[model samples]
Target: MTVLLIALGAALGAPLRYLTDRAVQARHGSPFPWGTLTVNVAGSLLLGGLLAAPVDPAVTALVGTGFCGALTTWSTLSYETLRLARTGKRRLAYANAALSVAAGLGAAFLGYALVTALTG
Candidate 1:
């Protein structure tokens, strides 16, 4: 049961992530990989909100473990950063790492706070 729910969530999440990455990359011209950053932060924010809310374990498993896991690609982020450095965009690579960490944290915190306030 749990596995099925998680799988279902991942099925939706993976494609959504791909589409979002495509759209963002197309809009930004693919220099800084705004797509990866956008998805990571968005996934973090969504996970934070879902966790903070009074939801069941199955809900957490499906959305947090599966959806967010599928939606956010740490491997891609690392690879893109490496590619940027290898291609001589070292500054952009560093910036990507820094921004991903900082913005991911900020979005999670903000999401948690917002959900808590709204629920309260």
Candidate 2:
């Protein structure tokens, strides 16, 4: 049951991640990988919110583990950063790494705080 739920969530999240990444990348001409950053932060925020909420384990498994796990791509981030560096965009590569971590953490904290405040 939990597995099925997780699979279902991943099925939705994977395509959503791809589409969202493409859409966001299309809007920005920078090769800084805005798309990857957006999805990672968004996934972190959503996972934080879902975890903070008084929800069931199944819900967590489905959305938190499955959806967020699929939505955020650490491998892509790594690859893109390497690509940037190799392509002579070293500054952008470093910025991408720094900003991704900082923003993802910030978004997660924000989501957790927001949910906690609202629930309380």
Candidate 3:
């Protein structure tokens, strides 16, 4: 049952992430990869919230491991950064790498803090 729930959550997360990335990229119209950045930060925030919540293990597995694991993609971010560097967008590549890591962490921390405030 846990496995099935995880799978179901991942199924929903993956396509949702894809569509979000596409939409954000379409709006941005640049190689900056705003789409991936958005998803990564958002996913981190969600996972952080779930971790702090008093939810069941199955719920954590589904939302944290399955959904967030698929939704937040380090691989894609790395690939995009590399592709940018390879294509001579060294400045943008560096900015993307730095900003994504920093902002993602901040977002996660904020989510955890929010949960703490509410639950405490």
Question: TM-scores for all candidates?
Answer: 0.97, 0.97, 0.97
Error of 2 at 3 (Å): 1.1
lDDT (tens digit, per residue) of candidate 3 on 1-120: 989988988998999899999999999868899999999999999987887899999999899988998899999999999999999999999999999999999989988999988997
What value does the lDDT take at residue 9 in candidate 2? 88
For TM-score, candidate 1 versus 2, the one ahead is 2
Q: Using alpha carbons, what is the TM-score of model 1?
A: 0.97
Please count the clashing residue pairs in each candidate, in the order shown.
Answer: 0, 0, 0
Tens digit of per-residue lDDT, candidate 2, span 1-120: 999989988998899999999999999989889999999999999988887899999999999888999999999999999999999999999999999999999999999999999997
- Per-residue lDDT, model 1, residue 70, is 95
Lowest-sum lDDT 10-residue window in model 1: 22-31
As a whole number from 0 to 100, the lDDT of residue 65 in candidate 3 is: 83
Off by over 4 Å in 3: none
Residue pairs whose backbone atoms clash in candidate 1: none
